[model samples]
Target: MKVASFLEDVKFNSNKPSVLMLMDTDFSKELRVVFKKGQIMEDHQAPFAIVVQVIKGAIDFGANEELIQLNDGDLVSLKPHIVHNLSAAEDSVVRLTLSKADSLQRVKNV
Candidate 1:
């Protein structure tokens, strides 16, 4: 079995959000994203469905121009190719889980 703490051992970047790849396998890919207050992850899209969970703090999540506020313990799912963006209202940690697909696609900025 494998285990990890998303809240521990986090790495931060001054120019961009910090990303940590927690797992990457045939079945799924898991990542941890850390954003400082006011940081924004510009709109992007993925080729496979994904689940995003807020682990700490808050964020404004936008999908296809629809905005929603997410706080710790809140989760949302996005289907393939849906345009999305994230802005941290405060320093935050988010976990992203991507399901298996023919190939993992990089987040394409919109």
Candidate 2:
């Protein structure tokens, strides 16, 4: 068995969003992403489907040619290779779930 906490040791970056691996399960990798207000993760694509959950604060999620405002406790899913981006409407913490086939480096690059 394994354990992790997204709320522990939380830190935010001034220049960009911060990504930290919370845990890796048999079929997926979970990440804790912290974004400072006004920070943005430019358009990026994943090779596998992804689930994004807003754990704290708010985010302006850009996808499907529109911007969706997501607040605390909100969750979203996107299909593989879909262009998406995120902007922090406030200091926020997001939970990102990636398929086991995905690469952590790709997320860190964004």
Candidate 3:
């Protein structure tokens, strides 16, 4: 197993999102994305499943046209092909855990 350390502060540029690949293998990719205040990931869906965890600050989630607010320590999963989106509020850092479609669906249902 690989051991990783916790992240401290991160910075993002204007009109661009900051992305960090915390872990990546042939089967999956784990990322830590930082969105500045008022940053939005835009409205879209992914081909695979993704899990979002609010590490710090706050985030607004939009899925199926429904809005959900997430704070520190909160976690959420996105189903494949589901319409979903994310936005940051006042300097937020979100951890995105992405995995294979089949594996994610099985995990989600279990």
Best by lDDT: 2
RMSD of 2: 0.7
In model 3, which runs have C-alpha deviations exceeding 4 angstroms?
25-27, 100-110
Query: How many residue pairs clash per model?
Result: 0, 0, 0
Q: Write model 1 residue lDDT over 33-82, tens digit each, in one string.
A: 88898989898878888999999989899998799999999999998989
Instruction: Rate residue 94 of model 1 by lDDT.
Output: 92
lDDT of 3 at 86: 80
lDDT of 2: 0.94
Tens digits of per-residue lDDT for model 3, 1-110:
76553266466767755777666667776677777889887776767778889888899988987999999989999878888778887778888787733333332221
lDDT (C-alpha) at residue 104 in model 3: 31
Sorted on TM-score, best first, the list reads 2, 1, 3
Per TM-score, the best of the predicted structures is: 2
Q: What's the candidate order when arranged by decreasing lDDT?
A: 2, 1, 3
When 1 and 2 are scored with TM-score, the better candidate is 2
The candidate, 2 or 3, that scores higher on TM-score is 2
Error of 1 at 50 (Å): 0.4
Evaluate model 1: give its TM-score: 0.89
